[model samples]
Each structure stands twice: as C-alpha cells, then as structure tokens.
Target: MKIVNVVKPAIRILPMISKDEFPRMSIEDVQNNYFWGELINNQEGMYNFRKIGMNAPKDSLVLFQFDNIIIASAELLDIEKFVIPKDGKYYGAYRFDINSVKIFEPITLAEINKIDSNITAFSQVKQEINSLFMVEIQDLIKSKQMPILPDELPRQYYGKRTEGAKRQIVVNAYERNYKARQACIEHYGCRCVVCGFDFAKFYGPEFEGKIHVHHVKPLSEINESYEVDPINDLRPVCPNCHLALHSKIDGKVYDIDELKSKIKRLINN
Candidate 1:
C-alpha cells in the first residue's frame, strides 16, 4: 500500500552511518550516550561545503542505514555551516540537525530478498544509498500494526557527517557559543588577521559585516568549561583565511601568527 503523506520526503534514505562510528564505544554504548541531541558534521557534503544541509529537508523522514539495513528513522531539523579544526577532505563543512529518532529492527538482505527479487543482492541495494521506495520504508520501519519486534524507545537523535559520511554527536561548547560575537567584532574590527583583507574595502559596504569570526583557542582545549574574553579569544577573518587558520595540514596547527608570516613570505617572493 502506498502510504501517502501530505509532505513526501524531499529525499528518502541516506546511508549516513556504518560500523565505523564512535570508535571507542559499542553501538549500544553510543546509543545511550551520544545518539540523541548529537551533531553530525562533514566538509565534503558539497564542493561549496555550506550546502550540505540541503540534502535533507525539514520535517521530512530520513532513514539512517547501516550494513545495508535500516537502523533508525530521523526527522530532519536544522542545517548550518560548521567549522572544525582538522586536516582532511572534510575540514570545515555543514551538518544536518536531526531529532525524534526511532530505531527499527535490523532489516537484512535475506529479509529484503524475501520481499523482492530485483533487489536480491545486499551490495546492489545498499549501493543505491538513498534509493528507498515508499513500500521499502513501510517494511523496514514496521512490519504491521505491531512495532518492529522489541520496540526501542525513540530518542532525540542528532547527526553530523563528514568525510565519507559518519554520524557524530553534538557536544556543547556552551561558553564559546554564548559569548557576545558582535562585541568581539566591534573591538577587533572586521578584517582578516592574517592578510588584513577587509570586505568593506574590497566588496563595498554591502559586505561590511561579512567576515567570519575565528576562535583563537580551540573549543576542544577549553577543558569542559570556559570564561571567554571575546576580544582576546576571537579574531575576525576572511572566509579563506578562517579556513586556513583551522587547517591542520600535516597534523599541525597552522596558527594565526604562522599564517601571517607565510603571507609576508609570499609578498616578499
């Protein structure tokens, strides 16, 4: 039966996770600790890095698959550009905000084969990651009126995928976020610390307030709690230099001073 929804999903299943997540913990362990209210991040979601959030639609269903079986269903929420300090294809990227997650019983290839011969092979089916037809979803999410086997309580799940699409949790760096960003901008002025690129001067007054603010000290280094002096802790930077500031190319922190020196070297050359 085609269960018609007034809002058809913008997209269906996204093979967003696998056995490869949260290396130190068991799936059960992560389920309890990190699954809900978590933020998943990825840089290579799109070439633009900012549009990764467009893949999922708000208030639509997205089935998270793992090992070729539907593991959970999540409601797509917010999408935003998230910058992280790392050297990789997904250095800084956008993330999906998911919530109201319901984990389904593991649906295997054998089970799917019983349902349809065309999708007989596991690899073939999973390769078509988001190729979920509505009937398939009905089977995976529920068998009938009864819930899928032993029902797991639905939890608030969040996701952040980057570099090959793995789901991650959101940790609150509450201090870093709650600080008065406008005050920092007022004190430092909107100019890239490394190259002194000012948007207003180059792109006109329309772009006067378009600079990205970067954290001088990494959020991870804040020791679980922090008192931030916005002026000292934050710096206004152009988008390109902001990315460079967090670039851990060759596993090294390319600090602001180092980037400034490199700019000088480039000029001298």
Candidate 2:
C-alpha cells in the first residue's frame, strides 16, 4: 500500500461531520459557496513548512463525501502556516481549505470505484490520494448534460412591459438573494459560467464578491411556494454574460448556453 505523493491534479475523498450527525445543511452551505474557515491539526492540512520549506501545492481536487456518497466537490485554494487563535491550531498549522463547484449531480461511490478500486482503497485522511480524481472528473464532465435552463420561464421579460399596460406588475427581483445567491456562487463556482472568467483571480482580493448572480428564470414565475433550487435554477455569471443573458432574439431571450456559443463564435471569428 503506497500513499501517493502530494502533487497537482491530485484527488482526495474526505468525510465531514455535523454536530447533529447530519451534514446535509453544512454540505448545502459549502456546495452553494466557498468554505475554508476551520483548521484541524494532524489531518491532511498540517504544519509542514519546517519539513518541506513551504506549504504543499495549492491546487488539487477535493471531494466531500457522506455515507459513501460524494455530495460535493471543491478546489484547493492555498495553504499557510500561521498562529491564529481563531483557527483551531496555530504556529505551523494547516488544513486543506477550498472554494468549490457543486457537481451538476451527486455521484455514488460504487460508480467511482467502477472507475478504479484503488481510489476507494485509500487509507489516509481526506485530501488527495492520487491522480485518480482526474479520471472521475473527466467522466463527470462528459456526463454534465445540463448547462440548460428550466422549461417554464415567464413570457414577460424583466423590466419590459407596455407603457399603458394598466396594472404594472412589479416583480420582486433579487439581484442577489443571500442564501440563493451564495448557493449559485458555489454551484457555478465564483467564476462566470459563460466565459469562465473569475474576478478574484483577475482583479485581486477587492473583487472577491464582484461577480453577479443571475436567476435562470423570471422572478415572477417563481411562485410563492416555489423554493429556489440553486443547482438548476440559478447561475453565477459575470456582468457581460448577465447582460448577454437577457439579449433578445426573435422574441426570445438568449439562454446561457446560447450566449456562451455566441461568445465563443465571436472569439473564434
């Protein structure tokens, strides 16, 4: 049994626990947005600068699982050795922290082991076992299938109605519904789903929450009882894509995929 070396494009299957023994809510919060504020000593994230002269590689694949089912996926942000009372341990302490993308769908462990049994055979604590993650991720991508919007969009475009339309229906729009928006951010990642543009990466820390959140459907169409489903119903798109999302064709608004293709064609031509 060989523990794989720490390297880029690595994979780790880790489990998370909630005080109540149910981690669904935590998984929801994390999958919907970024998570990285805690530190556990002697785990995958530990103070190793003294031995390696620096923190381990910052980029790797992280999978959060519960009861043998992989619930979410995240990306390694960075590692640091510091003394901060807030973080569980200090002075050469580290924990694998991440900002993630919600899988278009949850994946089962059996399905994963079908790809390679060695992945399930990993004995170390969570955080990168080997390059096996690349295979799983590639398979997941091939099966993504979604990148599409729901069927029932309101015929009415936002902010567009006849001047003398009598009763003006003011739609309750959320440029960002705190919970829903955060989920959208986590699901699509803090990057533009259209062009894959990330503000934080390009503009630095000040632009952390600079990206926009777009509802995949009209606010009016979401009924009183209609709970906003983050995965299928919301998206985190940049301003350009947000504007382009509302672009009209022959009396129809362009969907995200269409706009993406348009951007691609523009870039290609």
Query: What is the Å distance of residue 113 in model 2 from its true position?
Result: 0.5
Q: Runs in model 1 with CA error above 4 Å?
A: 1-59, 62-179
Worst 10 residues of 2 by lDDT: 161-170
lDDT string for model 2 (29-71, tens) is: 4433223112211133332322222233566666666555666
Q: Which candidate is the best by lDDT?
A: 2
Error of 2 at 149 (Å): 4.1
Tens digits of per-residue lDDT for model 1, 1-269 = 89976644543444543444446554433433344424322222221222133344455555555556655555555345547533433333323343244454566666655555555554412233233455665555666222211001112222221011123322221222323455678888888777999999998996777666676776555544444556777787777787777668889878889999988999999
User: In order, what lDDT does every prediction score?
Assistant: 0.50, 0.52
Q: What is the overall TM-score of model 2 with all chains considered together?
A: 0.41
What are the runs in model 2 whose C-alpha is more than 4 Å off?
1-7, 20-30, 33-56, 84-100, 121-124, 127-129, 132-136, 141-175, 178-269
